[model samples]
Target: MKKLMISVVAAALVLTMAGCGSKDSGGTKVKFATDAAYAPMEYMDKDKVAGFDIDFLAEVMKEAGLAYSVTNTGWDTMLTSVQQGKEYQAGISSVSITDERKQTYDYTAPYFESTNMILVKEGSPIKSALDLKDKKVAVQISTTADTLMTKIMGGDNKSLKRMDNNTLALMELESNGVDAVVADIAIIREYVKNNPNKKFVSIADAKNFESEYYGILLPKGSDLKAKLDPAIKKVIENGKYATVYKKWFGQEPDTKKLLDQK
Candidate 1:
C-alpha cells in the first residue's frame, strides 16, 4: 500500500511539470500587436484585420513554424503593452528601430526602411521643412517626427499640435488646420494612394528628415528573438522580403544603406 501511494505521488508530480512546460493551447499562437489603423501596414478590411505587415507576418510566421494572432491597439499603447508583458508577445507595426527604443526593448532585424517625408495639400505654400517655420505643424503624438520637429523648430515649438493617430493629423491638413504633416514616407504613400483627390507631394530635397528602419518589437529577454532574427535574415537573403515589398508598396527595397548609422 505504501509503495503504491509513493508511485501515485510521483506520477502526479510528473504530470504537473509536463503541463507547466507545455505551450499555450493556442498552439504556437503568438500575440502580435499593431496600430491596426495604419493601412498598408495593419488595418481593418471587411471586418478582417489585414495589411502589409499582417501579410508579411503571416509569411514569416509560417516560415518560422509559428502560429499567431493580431491585436489592433493604438500605436503608443502597442509599444508600452509589449514592454509591460501584457497580452501581446510581439509588435509588428511599422515601428522604427532606434537606439532610444533599444534602451527599453529589443528589436528584430529591420523588415522595412523609409525616410521621413512631409505631406501637404497640392499647391500648399509649405514647399519644404524650412518653409514651415512659425507655421502650425501636425504630427502623431509621441512619434519620432514629433521629437524631430521639436528639435528643428528651435527648442519649444509651442505652436505644434499633436494628434492621437495619423489619420486625424492628415485630416487636419486637409481642413487647413495645420500647414503640413510629418509622417513616414511609406505611410504617406498609402495615404496618397487612397486619397487621390488630395494631390499630395513630398517636400523636395528636405534635410533634417531622418530615415528609419522598421523592426518587430519583442519583449526584452523573450526567446522569440532567437527564432525571429535568423528567420528574418533568411527572408532578406532569399529575396523574399523584396518580393513582399513590391506586392504591397509597388516598389522594391532600396538596398542603399539607410539609418542605423552613427
Candidate 2:
C-alpha cells in the first residue's frame, strides 16, 4: 500500500536515483514501478514522486550503487510490469512480502512493518475488523487489506467493498457508502491527519490483523536481491533507515525488529 498502494491511473515518470545520481557498475539503468496513491509512502507531489518510499529508495539505490528510476504506475501495472522484468525490473510501493508473492517475485530483506487498520468516521460503532463482518467495508483491491478482510468476512461477503486504491476506499467512507475502509496503518493515519475536518478514526485490531513486512519487489529469480539485501541492511545498521523513518513517521522505528526479520 504506494501509501498501502504504495493507483487507478498512474502517469509514468523517469527520474534519476536519489543522492549521488550515478549509474550502476554495469551501467544498465533499471526501472522501478510503483502505484503512487498511498500517501506518505509514495504520492504525486505536484508532478514529482514524493514520500517515505521515494526517500528510502533513494538511499537503497545509492547504497547498492545501482542506477535506477521510479515511475508512477497503477497497482496492477506495477505487479505485472515487475513480473515481466522487461519494462520494470522492480517495485517498492509498500508491497508486502507474502508466500504467494514470493513464488512470482524475489523480495529484498524485510524493510518495514505494517498491518491492516480499520478506518471509520468518528463516533462510528465499528471498533474492529470483526465489527465489519456484516457491515459494508471498503478496501483497495489486491492489497493485503483486501485479502485479510476477505478471509474474515468470507470471499463472497457482499459487505466487502473493493476499490482500485485506498483513496477511493476513503472516499466511500466519506460519502457514507461503506461503514469503514481497511488499509495499511500508515495510509489510514496519514489520511486522518490530513483531513481533520473529516473526523475519521483508525482502529488497530491485533487480534484479526497480523503484522506484515514490506520489501523491495523483484521478478522471480531476479539477481537484484543479491545487491539490495546488503545495502538495505547497511542502511538499517548505520541509522540512516531510522532517520528516514523518523522523518516520515514522527517517531523512531523498531529498527531491531526490522533487522531481526531480515
Q: Highest TM-score: which candidate?
A: 2
lDDT per residue, candidate 2, 158-231, as tens digits?
A: 88998877889988999999999998999988988889998888899999999999999999899999998999
Tens digits of per-residue lDDT, candidate 1, 1-262, equal 0000001111111000001112233465677767666777777676566777776776677667666777666565666667876677888877877776777788887777666778887788777777767888888777777777777675467678777677898999888898888877767878888888778876743467756777888888888888877777776667777788788888777644422322
Best candidate according to lDDT: 2
Off by over 4 Å in 1: 1-26, 204-206, 255-262
- Cα-based lDDT at residue 141, candidate 2: 83
TM-scores for every predicted model: 0.82, 0.90
Query: How does model 1 score by TM-score?
Result: 0.82
Task: List all candidate RMSDs to the true structure.
Answer: 12.7, 3.0
User: Global lDDT for candidate 2?
Assistant: 0.83
CA lDDT for candidate 1: 0.69
List the lowest-lDDT window of 10 residues for candidate 2. 1-10
lDDT against the true structure, each candidate? 0.69, 0.83
- Cα displacement (angstroms), candidate 2, residue 112, comes to 0.8
